[model samples]
Target: MDFFEVINNRKTTNGPFDPRPISKEHQRILMESASRAPSHFNSQPWRFILIEDAKKRAAIADLAGRSMEKLIADGLFFERYRPYFRFSEKELEERGDGIHFDQLPGPLKPFAKQIMSPTGVEIMRRMGVPKMLGRDNRDLVAGSPLIMGVMLDKAEYIPGKLSGFYSIFGMGAAMENIWLTTHALGMGIQFISTPMEIPENWQQMIALLGVPDNLELMAVYRLGYVKEAQRRPSIDWSSRHRKRLSQYVFRDSCDTPESDDL
Candidate 1:
């Protein structure tokens, strides 16, 4: 498919992937395509770790289950509360982390709940992932037919602040590459970040991937041949166009022409 077409058609696949194995040549091609993704300062901070071992996949799934349990125990399963159940501003204030749950408009409540829920963890367990970390190991000690790992070099800034935020952007670029390459090769890929359940252990997860001390886990993707391609729901472009360009664009002065383009 053409590059632009691939971009337009690409969609996240959640159903079971084809159980067939992907070839090394194809894997290499996909990785190369992913590496072409743009990065800030050409830092090229992304790294990949692929998991193919059944046993290891199970272990990863177990970890995910435990993570979900932890979140549920902590009363962090926000998905349980829909718009039908509302919390007062005082209650939201007490649960503060700058997360103003009560302040979210009614229509956006479902989205807010998904963001704060342990959905990722639950999904991982449901998928039956095994290894906590590793790529394509047929044996306990050595190689496998296919599996890869992706990592990101950590920035020296605090999370969500300044340079640190760019790390995610760079990682996202690489991720896009991975998806495109895999799809073009007629293979499937799944990116898992739920294992990094405890944000505090983010560094530890990076270490497990054998990345440099300063690096962090960006994603863990699984690859395999897919028997059939999954279908994506059609998007409602009309809703996206609800707002006019003027709502977001601004001129130096209101008196100035919006622009010939406008």
Candidate 2:
């Protein structure tokens, strides 16, 4: 793929990774592209722990499940993130952001809408739906051939300072490099955020991964082959998946239109 083609074609491939191990050459290229991302003060604060062991992957997946179960048991899982979840097709249409049901499997559509209502969630809890969902998450994460733990080393970044912002910006650039490179290699990458959203879960994940105290895990993601062409959610695709360049870009001064060069 060419430069812009790679950028435009990249999409999250969480649902249908084919469970194939990435090639040695591709893995090398993956890390190289990540390292090449620009960093503040040339201080590459990011560190990665790549997991290929099946048993370890299973354990990590199970830990994620358990962490989720704990959250559900505490009766706060949905309560915490419910506001952030855009449930119905109506909500997606209005906001044009957040997870849409089209991004989920066809089977999960009704549940996605139902869970937003307090009564619906209470009913699911009584029926052990969250437990089942957590169990399913194990299979979900374990199915991936490569599990990447993206971390930031505190010592390498200037914490509590403007440099810290630069470090994070650099880390996002690195992840994008990884995403684009993975797509170019005919593979897919899906960011996993269940752990990062909850503090207890995030700590559990850190311990399960054996990451030392010196490094803070910023995010986790899975990588593998896609079984088929990934579907672009209609709500997102309707607008070509981004804001109009005019909405964010501008001309020479403040309120002017962008020039033709854009």
Instruction: Find the candidate with the highest TM-score and give its number.
Output: 2
Which pairs of residues collide in candidate 2? none
TM of each candidate vs. truth = 0.57, 0.81
Question: Which prediction has the highest lDDT against the true structure?
Answer: 2
Q: Candidate 2, which ten residues in sequence have the lowest lDDT sum?
A: 233-242
lDDT of 2 by residue, 1-262 (tens): 6999998888777464787788788889999999999998788888988989998888878876676666665557667766655656676655555554344345545676665567756766777767875775666788889999998888765677887788899999999999999989988887666677678778878887899988888888888877786545322212223434565578787789675367
Scored by CA lDDT, what does every candidate get?
0.51, 0.74
lDDT of 1 by residue, 109-227 (tens): 45544434466435433433222212221121121224466766665323877557776777777778878776776665554444565675444445445566665655565566555
> Candidate 1: deviation at residue 150, Å?
2.5
- As for model 2, its CA RMSD to the true structure in angstroms is 4.0
